[model samples]
Target: MSNTSTSSDTSGLSAGATAATIALAVVGGIVVIVIAIAIIRCIQKNKMQARNTSMQITSVSAVNVDSNIDMVTIERFLADIVKERPVRFTTQNIIDFTQNFAQKLGSGGFGIVYKGQFPNGVQIAVKVLHKTQDKRAEEQFMAEIGTIGRTYHINLVRLYGFCFDNTLKALVYEYMEKGSLDSYLFDENQKLKWEKLHEIAIGTAKGIRYLHEECQKKIVHYDIKPGNVLIDANFSPKVADFGLATLCDRDNSHISLTGGRGTPGYAAPELWMPYPVTHKCDVYSYGMLLFEILGRRRNLNLSQAESQEWFPRWIWHKFEGGELDGVMTNCRIEHSNRDKAERMCKVALWCVQYQPDTRPSMNSVVRMLEGEEEIIAPTNPFQYMMPFDGSSSQWSESRGYSTSTATTTNESEANILIHQNQQ
Candidate 1:
């Protein structure tokens, strides 16, 4: 009876072990299937991610290609249009000419100007443009090449060649021995003779006249500051820095601007506003430049007495009060140069008139500066700054200006009013 009982127990244990083994196998199969499915899903996810990454890369590459093509097209168009094609130099040539950037002439917002030389001992100023993510630098480069490359004038700086490599972009220009006009005008120690200054002013006016009237297309040099007027060994003035210059059809009454394009103190009132601008805007800038040239100092001098704080305003006061002789005396003008100085002052006033139509053409300015044409006395250029007190004759200190019937109590208020009017 004991043996039979033991046998029954053994049989039951074997059956239970078999059932447990079958359950374990089922669980193992399910786990294996789950792992295989997970692996497949991970592979698909990786492939999808790779595809997305590739698509993004392709999109970025396409954009880069388009930008490159646009630049190339501009280069080709400029080359074709320009009568005298400037020499296209390689990056290595730039490095060699610049002597690996050994002598830096100067630097500005655009880039550095390095003194360079050619094999034949011809001196050049190589302006290496700053690399930009946007196309502004490229646009400016093309503009300089397009405009100046097409024309040649004694008063205009000459662009000899250019390097438009992927890594380095530069412009090769004829070197000016005396540097910029501002160096002499602004420096107390470097005061030029009034006669020379007058000559420079006339030359600058002629340059502007050429741009406005003589060129096939009118090129308005929007930034006509002293810094842009370069002088050579002969003290001859040449207009430089055509980065802000724009070419327009002669028939177009005005040109549209995306934004203001000049030094603040020298910029026209219209440039700050959204008004459709004409070449007269350059006249206004030239007027501001004339103010600086007249003073041999900045337009705004806080160090001066209250009466003479703003040079233009003081000059206007003196001019209107029939004390232009006093202004000439203050500027230390020689007796012989007084007529030229007075002419410059009058021309400046006319150029800065609020109404664009009222401004004299650059041709007229040249004629006036050269004493070839009579300069009619200029009306008050600061009419915008006329006092609120019913008197139209004089500027009052206590009462500020008016813009379109609204009285502005302060300069800031006046600016806002002017901006609103422009809008």
Candidate 2:
């Protein structure tokens, strides 16, 4: 072979070898980075596992529990939920999946709700819960689910599972064709057309009644606004958010020591303020829902009475005096059922009465809405109205919520909160 030809072949071979080495080095560096990241993650995960193990709650005393009761229904509900075998979301899955066609449902103390569909052809509503990285929030979220997962009522929203494996901690629910009652009732879709609104009202009343009377334990949904309620394909109302529910025995006080959880405008002031309350707080929220149905979400601000300082009082007065026609945004529907509208308005007012004693049980509410029983006019509402500016003190004492007897559980103890009758 000629020297010149041999040298040319060797030179080409050397260049190719150099290129391959550089490529291999680049690949090696990438692998090292990935390995380092994975190792750090493993160490962090171990620490987290250790921390969670340390924080588990062991046991708690029931303010009043019947030890001899047969727990068949509760067991059945839990069995059904477990059979579904929902799992948490992993960060990798979210990164790989693109959220498709999400519509904003609502927002509150919780983050937000968006409607989305999975690639597997499943429709889901995702509730991005409010709290982030807070242990207390995690406890509350679990409390709501654990309590509700024990039963599947026609009225309650269906929980598929949750996503807690990573930073993506959110609740996954079956998508409802119709969004929250709040949007439907107030929006220009002419939602509060009397017939549709009335039907919704009846459905919601039935759901609440189930919570009160049908369930093994009474669950008080402190927040019952339109947003918390959702409509199905058949337009049946399903109570959506269980975030603020308190489950307790029926015979016991609805609230034991005191305090209630709900939105500011809808919550019964007396129950929320001085504490010690019952299902009446829910009744109050229902009243507000009724108002939303009839008022068509008109009064973001309710007016007050002469003695009644709160704005809800103002809205109530105008409603009773038949000023609803003027204030109602969905007035066009009244032409079809004026008397029906009037009856519903009266029922709404009755449920919202300031005194818990006067408010009807959810059973009564359902019956009244169905026209199976007549709804009587509520007694004077402001009877418990504050006499002085600091009337909060007297009201607290009178309502009888002694925090001295409040549930004595530490934050570390993870038992869910339930309410019952006052002893």
Candidate 3:
């Protein structure tokens, strides 16, 4: 009887052990399934955010735009982002393939650009935007790639690949051997010659014209300054930063804030006006850029103190009298080149006319620059008042006292344009 009882006890213990093992296995399987679901949700959430960029802009208020964000706020926003996808480089994997390729060419708000080579040994410029915290960054990354990808022109910069991952957001492009026209023109050391400068201006005008007329979509290169103009090995000018504004705008216009998106000197007067700006504003900016290139001067700091200004009426006197050529003439600006200089100066003076209607389109400018026909002399520019800052001796007697400064100093989609010192 005692032996039978012991056998029953051992059998019961074995059964209990088996039941416990099954329970443990069931719990482990459930945990794995839960983890997988969570990861999938995270990825989907990120992708969804990237697609809907307008929501982020909608979240902000007009009243709060001026007061809402500062360095601290931006810092907090960056910290909140959780990276889920890492950038996947799709360039060729072979060393001989992408090696001589992807050489770090330059760096900007976008990450460092790499020179990339394909299996066919094609050369391209790659601008890699620095990795950032959240979906906003990813949206910007994709927006630039998507917008620029669709836009193709011999004069416009080309986009190849955009890496949208948890760790990276980079752009691949066709490399421009010469950097920005701003560097070549204003770099004091390597300033271009008269004929080359003339060609650059003409090429740039054609590029801008193509954006306005030839492109499938109407585009306004809001930032049409020297920094954004690139020259190829053949000295052909191509417009970079082509689709930048649209990228930040989520591919639409008619936004709440438009005033402070461009450089101070190059920005249109409408940029400071109360009404929302439009494509005409780009025409105004293009005008300023044209003048800056020909004048060989930076207009932003033309008058720091009211007393230190050299402006509109003064410049007009110089231009109409044909003495404007003397002002921009350095060693590079010569007597033999005076005729070309005068023609460009006349064109420059005409471009910055105060009224939008008075300004010519880039297409017209291109034809004029290409020497297609003789350009007409400009009418007198409308006189305007700028609020003065107590002193007015250094400037002309016709100083307006407008002290307001137009600056889109803090913007995401806007360029980080600084006050470049003029010679």
Candidate 4:
């Protein structure tokens, strides 16, 4: 009986052990399955992250490709230029020439200019262009190379070479020791003689004439302010800064401009308006420049009296009133320069004529300034300021002049008409 009882106890103990082992196996299997699932999910997550990173990289590459398109165009243009001019320089060359950009000469909206020297000790002005999102820097770079790169003139600034690299872009120019013309015109301490100023005016006109009539493609120097005129050590003027310049086929009667391209006071009215523009727009800007040169003051100066606030209007008033001598005296013109000053004043009036066709060609301007061509008395350039009355020989003072009755007349008659209208 005792043996049988012991056997039953042993059997029960073995059954309990077997059931516990089975339960443990089931739980272990579940844990292993859950771990496998977790591992798979983690792998998928990693793959998704990698795909997203690749997509982002592709998007960036697409933008780079677009940018590269412009770069390629510029490179091709430069490559062609290089074949003829040998004016291409590497980024390392730029660094060497500019000595790591040690000497900063000036800074402007475009970028900084550094004084540089070559291996042979020839000095240069390195204009490093600002990187812009709008690609204006690139456009200006192309314009300078396309226009001035092909032409050479005594009065035009010389572009020595250029640096176009993946991370840098710059223009190398001949250094002008005397600096820009505005330094002399605006600074009282840096005064130039009237005779010298007259010569500069002629030189500038000749440069413009060359651009207008001589170049294979007519280049309109959209910005012709005194700031763009550089003076050499000998005080010779050279037209510089062709960033705003545009080239048009000579056969095109009017050039299509996307937008205005000059300083406010110097910009032609037609530039702001939706009018058909021609190289005559440059003539208009040059006229504004002449007014500044005549007074050695800005065209628009609020510091002066109300009548004298706009220098061009003041000159017109004095000129129409037969007080041009007063105008000359006010400008402190030398006695010997009175004739030259008068000619400049007349040329300016004609240049600013409301009708572009009435304005003389730059060739005629050169001739007139040199006293080789006759300057017919300029009709009122500011006729819009004084409207004419068709019923009578007078201009309407209240509302300004009528365009229909505007006619070309001699200086004496135009002055009389203006005086009568004032009365």
**Per-candidate RMSD, Å:** 24.3, 26.2, 25.0, 24.4
lDDT (tens digit, per residue) of candidate 1 on 114-151: 78898879788888877762476567678888887766
Question: Which residue ranges in model 4 land beyond 4 Å of their true spot?
Answer: 1-86, 385-423
Assess each prediction's global lDDT (C-alpha) against the native: 0.78, 0.62, 0.59, 0.77
Q: Between prediction 1 and prediction 3, which has the larger TM-score? A: 1
**Residue 23's lDDT in candidate 4:** 88
Question: Which 10-residue span in candidate 2 carries the lowest summed lDDT?
Answer: 414-423
Q: Which is superior by TM-score, 2 or 3? A: 3
lDDT by residue (tens digit), candidate 4, 266-379: 667787678998999889888988988899987766567768767887888888998999999999998889999999999999998887888889999999999999888778
After superposing candidate 2 on the true structure, give the runs of residues whose Cα lies further than 4 Å from its correct spot. 1-120, 128-131, 257-260, 300-336, 386-423
Cα deviation in Å at residue 143, candidate 4?
0.6
Model 4 Cα shift for residue 132 (angstroms):
4.2
Error of 3 at 46 (Å): 79
After superposing candidate 1, which stretches have Cα over 4 Å from the reference? 1-84, 386-423
Q: Looking at model 1, how many pairs of residues clash?
A: 0
**What C-alpha lDDT does candidate 3 achieve relative to the native structure?**
0.59
lDDT of 4: 0.77
Selected candidate, larger TM-score, 1 vs 2: 1
